[model samples]
Target chain A: MLVNVLNVISQWAIPLLLLIIPLYGFIKKVPVYEKFVEGAEEGFRTAVRIIPFLVGMMVAISVFRASGAMMVLGSLLKPITDLIAAPAEIMPLAIMRPLSGSAVLGMAAELMKFHGPDSFIGRLASIMQGTTDTTFFVLTVYFGSIGVTRYRYSVVSGLSADITGFLVSLYLCHRLFG
Target chain B: MLNLIWLFLLVSGILVAAWHGNIEVVTSAALQAARDAVEVCLNLVGIMALWLGIMKIAESGGLVNALARLLRPLMVWLFPSVPPDHPAMGAIILNLSANVLGLGNAATPFGMKAMQHLDQINPRPGVASEAMCTFLAMNTSCITLLPATIIGVRASFNSANPTEIVGPCILATASAMVVGMSVDYWFRRRNRRRRR
Candidate 1:
């Protein structure tokens, strides 16, 4: 019981600290950040402009899932997945794109729910979730906000990180847990 | 209109590639996926609101400024273009700190604020200067400290040891940042040579 309580407290600690300090801002209302406010408003406008782009990306991701391309891809990559120590069940899904982190998580959950965490599917999910981030989607929104038309090395570099992450996670999982 | 056309084509392409079967299933699935994203974002709203309030308070309380003062030397070395006491520097530090703690939704406004401050530094109206590009690179590859979202997903997925991911998360993010910064430096140097 005590251990569980400690775990809960640790989880909530940073969030609570984050909340308490901001009360200071509300009380003071410094004039310095007024320019910040104006800038933020501008950024908000940029965010609005980019929503259509995000929607398109999301819609595309959705359609891909619906069309069953994900499954086909997963099956074809089974050999590589096996090589990398990735959960064979979830490896193809991880390779799909950097956009839908949650969808992949959801898929991982489904796999784990039935198979158990130490199972191939569950460990793969755990590793994938830990290893990579939503690089392309985030870059689009961020760079779009600032109006960067030329993202020369960004695409390859970001995806390279994602792929590197996938392979590493696979290797780590098998080495450490398997 | 043209952007929208490009968007439509992109969506159609994904749908065409991914969905091979019944139209209804594919269409409904696509819609649900978007909805799921929104739903997750909505769930995150409370945390974001709390963090926003905290960030605002920190800014008002002058804590952010103090933090910037501490970061001064390093910031100067990394971003010589932006002078000390600059709002961009403050916002950049704040954004990095917040992102380190795994508050992405919270980090964004500060990121925007940083960019806006960068915009102020830029003499050119539309074109991004080198500093701006470097900052973008940094922001994109910034190291995440906590990996909150991943942990949450792990807990939800019934992992016995969600925290085990902490090590790999740190290593992987650090690698990306290193690679990103190196590439950014190489390109910047190459550009300078061309100018010389």
Candidate 2:
């Protein structure tokens, strides 16, 4: 019941905002189109500005993946995962979640396809993917856009959250769906 | 730290590839990743323009500020470094709201806008301010109410109940948020003391 309500809200949210913002602007005698165009000009510049940062971050991530480092890491971490009774298949998803968004999403879909979405692995993967954002990508784009080279402890904080999310997802999935 | 991670990825990747005799794969992956990065940025341009334009209109109509005011107390508490009436507060609020609603595309532009606003007030150029770090922490681990894309992916996989993970997802995300905020707070205090 709650999911249905959230689904409707998520679907309608953008369209509603698109309508309401301009309509409200028009009613308030604001030149909505002109303002929109002015703001949009920055969009092009912002996208261009983050190009170097994105390339640097993505190349490293891709190289890491292409070199089969993740698989090695997964194997190395197998003992702990086994001890916790978590499937080895889900380890790659957890490791990749904070590094790259698309990579983890692809893994989650593949897991669901291979294991069936109702299976424990599929459900666990789904929750893990949903609960965590791509920390490295976010840090790169957001901080890079503003040229913030000294991010201080942002990385530490983000990874801590991601780790917490992973553990919580594992525990919750086991209790709820196992 | 980012410097360390970048070096670690590159160094470890190359070493691992050499160990496995897969150096060519790493080389090709690097080139492909660079190209894909540009593609991702270009794709973002249109959506960024659309959202930024809408946001511009909202700002002009005072809607952004009004919305910010509606949640003034919460905004103040979350981002004390920002003035309650500042445009940064509004943009940050919009970004978080979009994130909560699972509007990833909308959230990005709003987040960029917020960062721009936050940067304007930053005393140190090229350094993340306290508010920026706090914002990033919250953003990277925000409580997700609707993980729309994941649900769609599950449904496409023929799950009997695609939304079954929603409750668990929310619980996990909420716990993540709590920890993220706490860690960010602790770091902020430590940094301040060191600076003093």
Going through the candidates in order, what fraction of the true interface contacts does each contain?
0.24, 0.87
lDDT of 1 by residue, A64-173 (tens): 66666566667788887667655556654575536566576677667767887666557666656655457656655555556654555555456556765666666666
Clashing pairs in 1: A22-B54, A25-B57, A67-B18, A67-B19, A67-B20
lDDT, candidate 1, B74-149, per-residue tens? 9987887898888789888987776777766767667766776787877675566667767766666667767666
C-alpha lDDT of residue A111 in model 2: 90
**Positional deviation of residue B95's Cα in model 2 after best superposition, in angstroms:** 0.1
Query: Which predicted model would earn the best lDDT?
Result: 2
Candidate 2 docking classification = high
Of candidate 1 chain B, the 10-residue stretch with the lowest lDDT total is: B1-10
Candidate 2 per-residue lDDT, tens place, B1-196, comes to 9899999889888999999997899989999999999999999999899999999999999999898999999989988888888899999999999999889998999999899999999999999999999999999999998999999898888888888888899999999999999999998888779889
lDDT tens per residue, model 2, A77-169: 999998888889999899899999999999999998899999999999999989978999889999888999998899999999999999999
Which CAPRI level is candidate 1?
acceptable
Best candidate according to TM-score = 2
